[model samples]
Target chain A: EAGVVQSPRYKIIEKKQPVAFWCNPISGHNTLYWYRQNLGQGPELLIRYENEEAVDDSQLPKDRFSAERLKGVDSTLKIQPAELGDSAVYLCASSSWDGYSGANVLTFGAGSRLTVL
Target chain B: AQTVTQSQPEMSVQEAETVTLSCTYDTSESDYYLFWYKQPPSRQMILVIRQEAYKQQNATENRFSVNFQKAAKSFSLKISDSQLGDAAMYFCALGEYGNKLVFGAGTILRVKS
Candidate 1:
């Protein structure tokens, strides 16, 4: 009954530097998602992956942010040339739902806090 | 585009008292789900309670319960006998069938002993 696991609970970087966040979802989970939370704000979806395919990623910043899920289990989100505004918490979540049952219950992991100077 | 709103930025509740967190959402989809998530200082989002739009019964879990008004598109969380552990940032989120969850700005709850 292990929950989703995320790495580097904290990260500090300077502007223009590249940073990456990792996520290991719960076992047997079919859907994975990445969210970004700014200070004093709720989380916003950045991308979602069903197995090896990214089903939704409309909110991801294509110019500097990219994500990948290999083997349909673990995922990695990368931000190149990070900006000062990139300082935020990156959250990872997983769900057992297949996106058809009219229920999408997600379990989240301890987010990675990124600080860009 | 749908949106979730939490007018209260912060609230305080005395220990052993009751407090209600208000949330309102805009969704055209008739069938959807509402959720309350608690984020502690650890930065983990934990599901507190959820209510399905189609269900008439409000969801209740331990000291947590939700008053869901589908017609009015309002979902509020009520914490009875609030404990110090209840202090955190609470987020109201909405999810449609097979769609992303829309989250509000969140409300910070302070518990005074």
Candidate 2:
């Protein structure tokens, strides 16, 4: 079984430029998530998708950050006009199901390291 | 709102020895899941162990185990006979019905020879 896959393992961009990260979750997984992790800090959820529908995006920065999970198999997180503070690791994870049971285990990708100059 | 806290920013232990990393959380909900993830230099989040809120026996996986104190809202990871390969950043995370995770600041473990 293949694990979660992410592209552009590392990215570098200027402060005012636009950057996007992509994620392809494990096969048959129904839930997908996007998280941001700063140096020395754990990951914080930015958005969640349940089969192509964004069910939670309260933590996403509406002004500069946007995400989409079209078809629910893959996801993209975009940050336009990036800021220096946006330099961090963007991680994507997926789970098989929700609620009780199903092991509820999350398989995470290697993450895309975004460095905003 | 739910929050997870990792009191120790860093910890070190001699090879073959034991070390424990502390974690605490605040939540009003009764049903949830707690997880310990180890991220090495490779940056992959590896699931070391997990515990369900309703379980009392605790969760153990080989050299890794969790001490889950439900009343105190504390979940600590104990690594027995630590190895150099265990050097990594360990994160404590919480999740409910929707698969949304709330993570703590994380603890860095250094294994000494």
Candidate 3:
């Protein structure tokens, strides 16, 4: 079984530039998530998708951050006109949502590191 | 809503020794789960162990075990016979069914050989 996969393991961009990160979750998983991790910090959920529909995204910065998970198989997170504060690692995770009995255990991808200069 | 806290910014333990990392969380929901995840320099979050809130017995996996205090909302991880590979940033998380998992700021663990 393949783990969650993310692209552009590293990214460098200037402030005000647009940056996007991609994620492909494990097969058969119904729930996908996008998280951001600042330096020396844990990952924070920016958005979560249950089969293509975003169920939770209150934490996302709607002003410049947008995310989409088309067809529920893969996801993409974008930060438009990025700021220095947006310099962080974008992580993607997935889990099998088995109704109420679900463990909600998440499997994560090797995040895309974004460096805004 | 849930919030997880890892007060320890960093911890150090010698290889082959034991170490405990402390975590506390706040949640109004009765049915939820707690987790400990390890992130090395590789940047991928790996599940270390997890505990169901309703379960009285703590969760254990290999050399890792959790001391779950429901009343105190404390979940501490004990790593026995630590190895160099154990060096990583450890995060504590709380999750309810069909809800997003809330994470702590994380504690950096250094294993000295």
In candidate 2, stretches whose alpha carbon ends up further than 4 angstroms from where it belongs are A98-103
- Among all windows of ten consecutive residues in candidate 2 chain A, which has the lowest summed lDDT? A96-105
lDDT per residue for candidate 1 within B13-36, as digits (tens), equals: 999999999999999998889999
Per-residue lDDT tens digits of candidate 3, residues B1-113? 68999999999999999999999999999999999999987757899998989899999999999999999999999999999999999999999877989999999999998
TM-score of chain B of 1: 0.98
Error of 1 at A69 (Å): 0.3
How many Å off is the CA of B113 in candidate 2? Answer: 0.7
lDDT of 3: 0.92
Candidates' TM-scores?
0.97, 0.96, 0.96
lDDT of 2 by residue, B15-110 (tens): 999999999998888988899999997678998998989789999999999999999999999999999999999999988755578999999999
List candidate 3 stretches off by more than 4 Å. A98-101
> Candidate 2: RMSD over Cα atoms?
1.3
Interface RMSD of 3: 1.3
Ranking by DockQ: 3, 1, 2
Q: Model 3, residue A103: displacement in angstroms?
A: 1.3
* Model 2 error, position A4 (Å): 0.7
TM-score of chain B of 2: 0.97
